[model samples]
Each structure stands twice: as C-alpha cells, then as structure tokens.
Target: MHEVSICEALLDQLTSLAAQQGWPRLRRVWVRLGLLSGVVPDALEFAFAAMATGTPAEGAELLLENEPGHFDCAVCGELELERMDFTCPQCGGALQLLRAGRDLWLSGVEPMPS
Candidate 1:
C-alpha cells in the first residue's frame, strides 16, 4: 500500500537526520495525520515496524495525531464541519474547503543519546 512507500520515505529521512545529529537511536516519532488523508494509521504503524527492523529506529514508537477536516462558509463567516456537499447549512451557499486533511509529516522525534 501507499503506507509502505510512506514508511520507506520516512525511514530514509530519519536515517539521514539521525546521522546528521549523531543520534544513537530513535525513541519516538511523532506525526500529525490529516483526517482526509487516505493513509490508514494501523497500516502505517505496521509498515513502520516492519521497515524499521535492523535500523537505528528499529524499536522507535510511531505516534500519530489525527486532524479533522474543515470548511469555510462565506455566509456563516467561520469554519464549519459535519455538512454534506460542502453547502452552507444556514444560507445554502457553496462552502469553501479550508482543510482537506492531506498531510503526512514528521512533527517531532525523541532521539536516544549516543
């Protein structure tokens, strides 16, 4: 799945970062996952565990933070959620999608001492 490729890319980045910082190992990898992102958390986790084997980040914990989707309604003057077709609930006007939840990134990492 795409998560496997995502994991591969992530490990590659981590390896480069670890080498640059002289970090012995990674204790945790914190990432923020957008709700609209099609990547599955469980699948990503599994991929990370499998891909990290034998690497410095082998035993590292992959933590995910989920973000929700949001839309802005011009008539409402603020962001809204829980509406289908992206139409304003009050004014029936078309709503603008502010966040589509497409994000996969590393937010933080705990590096083990050398």
Candidate 2:
C-alpha cells in the first residue's frame, strides 16, 4: 500500500527535522489529515508504528487531526461542505474548493524529554 511509502517519507522528514533542530528524539508527531486526502488513518498509524522501529521516532505518538472540507460558492461565499455534496444549497451552483480537506501534512512535533 502507498501508506507504507507515506510512512517512510514521514520518518525521513522526522529524522531530518530532529537533526536540524538538534533534538535527541521525537516523542510525538501531529499530522493534519484532510477529508479528501484519501489516506486511511488506521493504515497510516499502523504503517508508522511498524516503520518507526529502531528509529529516532520509535514509540512516538502519532496524532491525527481532521481538517474539514471547505468550499466556496459563487453566490454563497465560503461554507463547509455538507455530506460531501459539491452543489451549493443557496444558489444551486457548483461549489469550488477553498481550503481544508485536500492535503496531508505534518503540523507539529514534540521532542522527547531530556
């Protein structure tokens, strides 16, 4: 699954970050997952846990935060999507994506206790 590759990339990023920041290890990792990211949370967690073995991030807590999908309607301004529908309720027009629910990124990290 691509989740394995995703975890591998994440570990690489964590390793680089720890080196750049001079941190001994990472205790936690916070990832922001969008509703449309297509990445499974359970799969990501399982992959990360497995891939983190013997690494600096081993035993680190992987926390996921959901980013709600937002859309912009020509006649309705910005609004949160409802039921994953792309139609505007007020104007019956197409809704364009504005923000959220389209990306997967690391938001924060906690360094291991000294």
RMSD of each: 3.6, 3.2
Stretches off by above 4 angstroms in model 1 are 73-77, 80-96
| Candidate 2: stretches off by over 4 Å | 72-77, 81-100
Candidate 1 to truth, TM: 0.76
Ten contiguous residues minimizing lDDT sum, candidate 2: 81-90
Assess candidate 1 and give its lDDT: 0.82
User: Candidate 2 has which clashing residue pairs, if any?
Assistant: none
Clashes of 1: 0
> Model 2 over residues 18-112: C-alpha lDDT tens digits?
98999888999999887787888999999999999877899999999887788899888998852366788778999887766666889999999
Prediction-by-prediction clash tally: 0, 0
